[model samples]
Target: VTITDDSEDDCQYEEVAADDEFSIQEGDEDLPKALQTIQEHAEDAQILASQSVLLSEKSVSEVPEAVDDFLCNFLVRLGMSRTLDCFQTEWYELIQRGVLSAKDTGLVPSVYTRNQELEMENMHLKKDLENYKLAANKAKEALLKMQKERDFHRMHHKRVVQEKSRLICDIKRLKTHYASYEPVLKHLTEKYQTTLRQKMLTNLERDRAVGQITGLQAALQNLESG
Candidate 1:
């Protein structure tokens, strides 16, 4: 049998017979019963397909009840009594624990809102972290500049101190040399004064001797003439 949807889509249904010894042959009394059973199975298949389409179109928040109903029917149909019981127990526990609540489910608007808020906060934190990293780099650069300036000043100060020490040593050496020559300079000055005075006295005594010799010569000439 074939079922066509509102959109004119044709869906074909193929029925498989269950593994049973009941075979309906032509002109058998069970032919009508077999036909009725096939029709019932075809109706059930059509209803199941429609339900599946509805479930697929429904949102997660609207799915729990539909899923529960579908599972109950499916388990009973399949004769999985024990599995059905276990599934019901687990489903009840989840519902009680609020795990299947509408608010906790991703179908709610609040979940999306909360996710947007978290994303905004994460963006802000990342921006702040970048700013902090830039500040740290600037601080490191400033520290390096200060260290270089300090090193330069320290080197300049050391050189100045060394030059000052050298000048002080030179001054002391010059003072010592002057001190050692002071007495010799003083003795030379006194000796020069004494030599000047002795030269003046010797010149005066030579002039007196020359004047006496001239007067005796004049007396001798006058006696010879008389």
Candidate 2:
């Protein structure tokens, strides 16, 4: 009974492990989702930058140093700082504009910060996704291994059952043969006893006949003498 329970529990445990693996797979799927979100935002930023080229040129002069630093950092982080030649060239002119307010300059820095934050988040999520996928694969492999082992056990179980049945059938046949021969064996014993009794009786009769013949011969001799 304990063995039966253990076997059932092992099967259940394997199933649970497989389910855990699937859960990890689902978790990994979210990793790509976060990356996709970041990519979409990056694309949006690229589109905004392309459409607002003049805005970049105009803000370069009037934008605060903090905003300027933000743009520089953003470009550096994105590996595009060296390619900002036109933005750099127009910086002097925009500084001389003296028309746009500081508030108007804040937008670019905010966008850059937001992009950086999104990128970092996406990278973190990607790492998590990789871990999840690894776990899922490991669990799936274990499940497959368990299934193979279970199948082997099942086959062995079937063989054992078949062997047990065969043994039981053999035992029954032997028992039947033994039972069928019991009466015959008994009859043989009885016949042997009867034959021994008949032999003893015949020997006794022969001895008596010999003794009577001897006595008669002796009497005949006595008469001749007289």
Candidate 3:
């Protein structure tokens, strides 16, 4: 009877080991299903990320044209509105609006999607901040360049004024030297004085006639020559 008890105990031990082995194999069978679920989830997440990025990049003016797209379509199908009449402020307000009830599209997986969205938004904000910093730096550099150009122009204007004053002084000295020759040159001048005076008067009258016409025309001609 003692030998019989020992034999029974040995059989029970072997059976327990065999059951453990079976259990391990059965657990392995569930792995494929879990992996497949994960894969499907990852694919959905990728699609959602792509869509979110596209939506974020779209201009305010461009949003209405995509009225039949995912979020809009979903809202419309839910009997929210017929037209995509919501503007910029209304759009953001809607995102912040809490749902009293929502579609039970698998709560666990929907939470995962929401997590992915939050991570995506964080990444987008970081990138946007970087872009804004870069733009601000560029504007500063451009402003500095403009200021330098303005300073250079101011200095050049001062130099031009000084040079103009010197040229005028030289012209005055030359006119003084020519004044002595004016009397001796009268014999040659008298030969055609009457004709020259008549020509000068005619030119003056022509100029006065042109001045009486249109001031705008004269201004336009001055601009074109410059």
Q: lDDT: which candidate is best?
A: 1
Model 2 Cα lDDT, one tens digit per residue, 1-226: 0011232342222223524323333346688766776676668768867867875455544433455556566577678855565565566467678554666444454455667679889989999999999999999999999999999999999999999999999999999999999999999999999999999999999999999999999999999999
Worst 10 contiguous positions by lDDT, candidate 3: 1-10
lDDT of 1 by residue, 1-226 (tens): 1111332333445676663323445576786798886787768878988997875455333322334655566577669999999999998889898879744332223454456458768889999999999999999999999999999999999999999999999999999999999999999999989999998898888898888999989999999998
Candidate numbers sorted by TM-score from highest down: 2, 1, 3
Candidate 2 lDDT score at position 201: 97
lDDT of each: 0.73, 0.71, 0.64
| TM-score, structure 3 vs. true | 0.29
Considering TM-score, which of the candidate structures 1 and 2 is the better prediction for this target? Answer: 2
lDDT of 3 at 161: 100
Estimate, for each residue in 1-226, the C-alpha lDDT of model 3 and write its tens digit.
Answer: 0011232342222223524322333455688776776676668768968986775455332322222244454455456674555633465465467432233211233354456458668889999999999999999999999999999999999999999999999999999999978987996788689889999999999999888777878888999999
For model 2, what is the C-alpha lDDT against the true structure? Answer: 0.71
In candidate 2 the C-alpha lDDT for residue 130 amounts to 99
Compute each candidate's TM-score over C-alphas.
Answer: 0.49, 0.54, 0.29
